[model samples]
Target: MMNIRRAKPSDKDFVLDFCMNTFEWGDYVYRVWDRWISDPSGLLLVYDSSNFPSTSKSIPLGIIHIVKCLGDILWLEGLRVNKIHRNKGIATALLKYSLNYGINNGIKESSALVSTNNFPSQKMLEKLGFSKFLEYRYYNINLKKYRDDCNVSIKPDLVFSKKLDIKISQFRDIFSIQEYLSNPEISKFCVSKYFDSWRLYDLNTSLSSLSSFVRNKELLIIVNDIDEIVGIAIVKPSGKISFNGMPMIQISYLNCLNLSIFVRVIHLLLMNYCDVNLFNNAHFLLPVFAELEKILSTKSIENSDRFFLYSKFLDTTSNLSSILPANLQ
Candidate 1:
């Protein structure tokens, strides 16, 4: 028999051990373990089976986490199962439990990021009704190398502000950001557009739980000659260096209406954010946009990773085609 329960502080070591022993490539669960358990808006569940019992406690057979991204946009991540527990319907049960939890709590849709090479996981998500919506390419760079190669300089005229009228407190920021992104002229500057399901959030719930985990977070907004906000860059902490075996700052979002502005903002991010040495190392993570990639290609940085964003609307009657861009579908 298998039993599932909400993970408590005492179960931290068991959960971390299970993740470390199960995954052979790399592990992100340990990096976010503390945050997941501490986040009030998220749920971390552990699965225990009599089949994997230990002398001290029931060794967890599997684990899953549900993170509330905005309103109805719940991010499912850190799904893992012990080797002895594979092919035994453990993963399916955990997924169903998570989905049901979301539905009972008023979640309308769920989203997840999966590696392109992980076919089994992708198959599982698809079997569970998820659709592959977008693919994001990320580039990882060491600050030491970046400084050595980047000789060109641009003025830091762009202003960084978190006081924009749009607040991400409870999904309100989505509307503000979406309005700017919906502009065809501005959308052209982006490599990929935001998914429709992500834009929709429950109006009744409080999204303030999101602000706790992010550190040194800020919104860098760029203005045009007329002093109007033309572009925005979202910045957040990349967790500890040991989490991914490196220190890096993750630029969650970057948008600009023109190449000149984009170049200026990119330079500013490197000089201001990536210059610090955290955990004895300096590095940064920047998603490779087509325009930025072209400009940085001359600097000899290699593309680090490519992943796909998968989403599933719990509502069977959802008109996803209407919400999603024609090209994305």
Candidate 2:
């Protein structure tokens, strides 16, 4: 028979190896294993054989983690199973365990992101009553590829032209962004309601405990001519490190006034960043906000990957309409 239990420190190596080899997207488990095992607001569970004792300890066949976020949200992540143990109901059992954990812990809801192409995972989430309420697109900008194009000198006419002095500044404090998100106009456009400044604070404060490979990051904000905050982007570093020891920077959480402004800010940011050689490349996670959908729909870029968010509410009265935007007329 199989046994499900909280993962221990000793199980870290096995779990890391299992994740690194079994996953094709990237290996993130090892980066957060230490923190997950010790987190007060998180759980790391493993499925293994305990009834049939072997000469050595039974390795974990599957593993899953759940983190408590702001707004009493339980975010499920890093679900992985050994290839040899596929179709053994391990994933389902793990999900049920997560539900029970949430209920007992007083978390009202849980959510996760699944790749659009990964139908099996989507089906599994749907079977468990989760609803796919939102979609996000992830785009990777190869600084090396854009380096040549961005290296050109500014045009003399443009240099003398009068324009809004839009500038990008790194957010040193989290509360500034928190206050910005509280605006009804901006909050309504956000993809994750629970993702506030407090969440960003928690991320910076708690992520250090997870591993040294991942760096604490900050947000880049765009200020307009009159110094009004217009757009913002998150600069996060992933768990995986390159062969040369540089970690990839995820340039996500992007929200701007318009496509033209976004393109200009991104180009300016990239130009300045490439001069310093911060990372090998950067990724942009695009949420389907108001006009962004139409802007991208008109473009022919095909290199980005898409992911969908599915949320399951433990409270019976809760509805997807509460969190989702109304259909456009």
Candidate 3:
């Protein structure tokens, strides 16, 4: 019999230990895995029965991390089974539990990403109910090595500073990006989540949680000749951040295209939006990504990640296999 339950706080250290002892994910993310407890999303645990045949240790068989948004999707990450217990049914049991948990929790989709060379893991995920929808290419740029590249200065009517030195709180002052996504033109260009703004480092103290929060936390709005908002951009310090250990940039609201006699504001942030010490994932329109890259390549922003317009589907026969749903979390 296997025991699966919500991971307890005390299990944090054990979970980290099991993962570090079982797999290899570079030294950086290795340590960061333990910090995931702060996530308001979801995280879980896996344990084996009398099968491992151990004497003194209540070693965990595996561990899985999850993140959830308002929708029915959940992201599964950091799935690990101790090397000493590989051949057993521990991994299989963990997946089954997660899948069952998803269906019960109103989660329509659950998913994850596996490297091309990771054969056994790929086979395991597919066998459990996952399918590949896309392949991601990762890249990186050293800020100091290429700082001469940013060239967009066509300012908006409003510029949300990268430093949160100002205190504006009204809707006009602090316009949440998600609130603006309903606008037809704006929604089309949105490649991130509504609550993503809430997840920025401005709200957290951990450096891993910090990014260009100092930059992108401020919202910018640009308008056309008629005062209709048209474009928006962010300015982030050159750094990186990700759920687990991916690289990213913290970009602040730059120039919005048009439409604004009102104020644009932010709640908190502004330590070092451009601090060379962190990482962030300032984004561009999904389509603009390619163009932005070619343009940034000429300058110095390192391109080391794939910014997904992350989506998940749910149903009785949906993509039950490939997703890493936090709901299942």
Candidate 4:
């Protein structure tokens, strides 16, 4: 008799055991387990298979996590199944339970990010009624290589130093940022999401929503000679540390009006925000835009992988029985 239940501290060992080899490099499930278990606005669920005849004691076969983002968006992530338990409907069952939990909590929509190469996961999401919403690519910029190749000085003060026709400055005014994001021309180029502490959030431009970034001093603006905000960058520390033992930072959301300004911002960030000794690499996700691709390729920056953001609307009145596999239902 398999069952699903809210995760507890006792299940940490089992979760970490299966999650340790989740990827080529490793996994971040251990890093976030405590936080997810304690998050009041989120749910961490574990798949219990201890009651099965083959089990002698408590056995956790899988896990899934979901958290409420801005507005009615439920961000789902960290779905993992034990290696020996793969293809047995554990992942599907966990996801179905997550969606039903969201519906009961008044969540209007649900979204998850999956690697472009993960065809099995993609097929499962499609079967569960999620549609592909947007495509994003991760670019990893090596701070040392970037700075040495570009011959830029890594000075903290360089953040405000003028270069060519533009300069980078931290923006703290929530109202101004909100107003800027409201521009149709600008908003169209922006992804509808951002990252905070490795958790994805819906891009909310309201004063209330923008205030947190402002308070944390994570928001930066690229201004031209005339002080026009032509670009924006949101930086935050990643949940996982780099393999080199240094911290990693993410340029969560970045947008610029032109290639020149974009390159300038990147250079400034590598030289200033991303300290070579302090950070291993800086990564960001950008939409699959042709012009952006041209700029990145021209600059010789390395793009790691492509990801798809899948989303689904949860109708409160609809039957969720189809979400689970026929046997599970």
Query: What TM-scores do the predictions have?
Result: 0.68, 0.71, 0.54, 0.83
Tens-digit per-residue lDDT, 1-329, candidate 4? 44788888999998999999776668878888888999898888888886356778877899998888876788899999999989988898888888887786778999998998999999999999999988877777666565564454435333444643323333454555666677777756667677665456777677665666777767777666666677777878654445344566788888775644665566666666444367777777666662334433334364466788899999887656554322322
Error of 2 at 78 (Å): 0.8
- Alpha-carbon runs more than 4 Å astray in model 1: 21-25, 51-57, 151-182, 189-217, 223-230, 238-247, 259-265, 274-303, 316-329
Ranking 2 against 4 by TM-score, winner: 4
Give the worst 10-residue stretch by lDDT in candidate 1. 196-205
- Could you give me the TM-score of model 1 versus the true structure? 0.68
* Best of the two (3, 4) by lDDT: 4
Which residue pairs come into collision in candidate 1? none
Runs off by more than 4 Å, candidate 2: 21-26, 51-57, 152-219, 237-244, 289-304, 315-329
Give the TM-score ranking, best first.
4, 2, 1, 3
Least well predicted 10-residue stretch by lDDT in candidate 3:
262-271
Provide the overall lDDT of each model, using Cα atoms, as 2-decimal numbers.
Answer: 0.58, 0.60, 0.45, 0.72
lDDT by residue for model 3 (137-191), tens: 3334444333222224313222343322332222332233333433565434333
lDDT of 2 at 249: 62
Specify the highest-lDDT model's number. Answer: 4
In each prediction, how many residue pairs overlap at the backbone (N, C-alpha, C within less than 3 A)? 0, 0, 63, 0
Better by TM-score, candidate 4 or 1: 4
